[model samples]
Target: MFRTFVSGLILLLPLIITLAVVAWLGQFIIDYVGPSSIVGHALTTIGFSFSASQIVAYVIGLIVFLAVVYLLGLAVESRLRSHLSQFLDSTMRRIPVIGNLYDLIQRFVALMDKNDVEGLKSMSPVWCFFGGLDGAATLALLPTPEPIMVGDKAYHAVLVPSAPLPVGGCLIYVPAEWVQQADVGVDKLVSIYVSMGVTSPLKIPPLPGPGPRKGNLTAT
Candidate 1:
């Protein structure tokens, strides 16, 4: 019975949280945009009670907000809008304190964007080993296979992003031989990190044994 209850809670937790957020948003809109607004006044004049009019106004505001977002999304797809976006971003980056905040927000937004996440995942994923010979492995996105030359030495650039919150992380430069490209998808790696290892794979399939053929070790 305890196990069953736990399973049930796990199944319903996401739905419950989503409903809670929606309810909170509805109440917030009602309090700010519903009461004494034009829509509420119009509804009240049309025979709705004052309280009922406020509720109706809240719904209207939500609908308008969604419609605006849809329209904005359509606008963003245009070439002119794309350039305008770049210009806006550049302008924002010039601000002092706001620049850092904007950069963090931009990274967070890019990480959350489905297309961007998918694209990063589609590129090769790797387990980066840091701290030289004795090192800890970290999941990272392998953006390039070519080693960066610093003086006469070469180093691999690995993107190690934080999990539970994918907004912040570091780009580490490590010895090329220490980085092991993982045979895993971006989604799997993300899930593991976001869940803080709660959703780690039961078994990581064994990497291939020594085999013939294949030239340089290239990215997928």
Candidate 2:
């Protein structure tokens, strides 16, 4: 009896979550278009002064917002606007702490944008071993090919994401030989990480490089 109840709950959980999300979104729209909201007041000023229905207000406001966003996207694609955007971006990056935060956020957003053809598609998934410890390997993304040169030696820059939340983690430069490509897609790796290894592969693949190095894998 207990087993049956558990199974039933598992089956219905997704549906329940979906409905809850829909309900919350509906309530949010209603509130956003309520009498006291900025959109509501704007609508009144634009000769929609007689419409008291929240639904009507919500539909109109949502349409207006979407249209504005669409137009802005089109404007950004224009050559003049594109150059202006680049200039603005460069100006923002000249700031102190805010510049650093902006860079981090930009990288994270680019990583999450699947539709971005030239974004993270360039990143390679890899299993990185620090100190040559086979058991202490971390899944990471190699975002660039340019190696960090130290005198004659070159080290690869890698980002090791925190499980369940890839946005937060360490950025380390390691020898290219210490990092081997992981046999998994970016989206799949994200799922496994977010699941805390629960959805991990049954068997991990071997590292791509040749035989192991004789000495420990040092960062320098």
Candidate 3:
């Protein structure tokens, strides 16, 4: 009976833990800056009370954060963002431990925002093809170039990411011809990768081939 209970818990633990953490964070924020009784009393005498307006501040903060993000996205395209990011990065790099953490976070955010077609084009799937059949493989993009000289044949570099997670991986430079485009959208490919290949898009069946006519010979 204990073993069975443990097995069931193991199955549902991740989802339960996720919800618990979300709830805790929400409550923590709400309690930390929520209106106090004194503020509530002052507002109440002045036509508002903490009990009546406690949620207003939290709601405003959330709205402001979202609005800022939306406005930044509208105003700044990749080129602009890249320039701004470089400036910020340079400033951050001057700091100590914070600089390293900032750079790591910046790289993560850049990878996550690869929805732009130009950015998406740089990322290609690393296929493991054999005899006209291609199965499990990884996708990657070239964020930086590395110069390589193999027996006097010099070449640039490419970054190859492991499957399921692009951020955790290495960089290697294969010949340009070897890296072929998968022609898949970055969003869809990310979904497939995150789900570990379970979430594939629906395939369309080919049109039927021409078949010999059976009836209607009388008209001919």
Q: Number of the top candidate by TM-score?
A: 2
The best candidate in terms of lDDT: 2
For model 2, the stretches where C-alpha displacement exceeds 4 angstroms are 1-88, 96-101, 211-220
Best first by lDDT, ranked: 2, 1, 3
The digit string of per-residue lDDT tens for model 1 on 71-126 reads 87887776666686778889999999999788656654554556665345334677
Candidate 3 lDDT over 5-87, as tens digits, reads 99999999989977986797677655654445453333334432222453564455445556888888865765587677568
Q: How big is the RMSD of model 3?
A: 15.1
Q: What is the C-alpha lDDT of each candidate?
A: 0.66, 0.70, 0.51
> What ordering of candidates by TM-score runs from best to worst?
2, 1, 3
Worst 10 residues of 1 by lDDT: 208-217
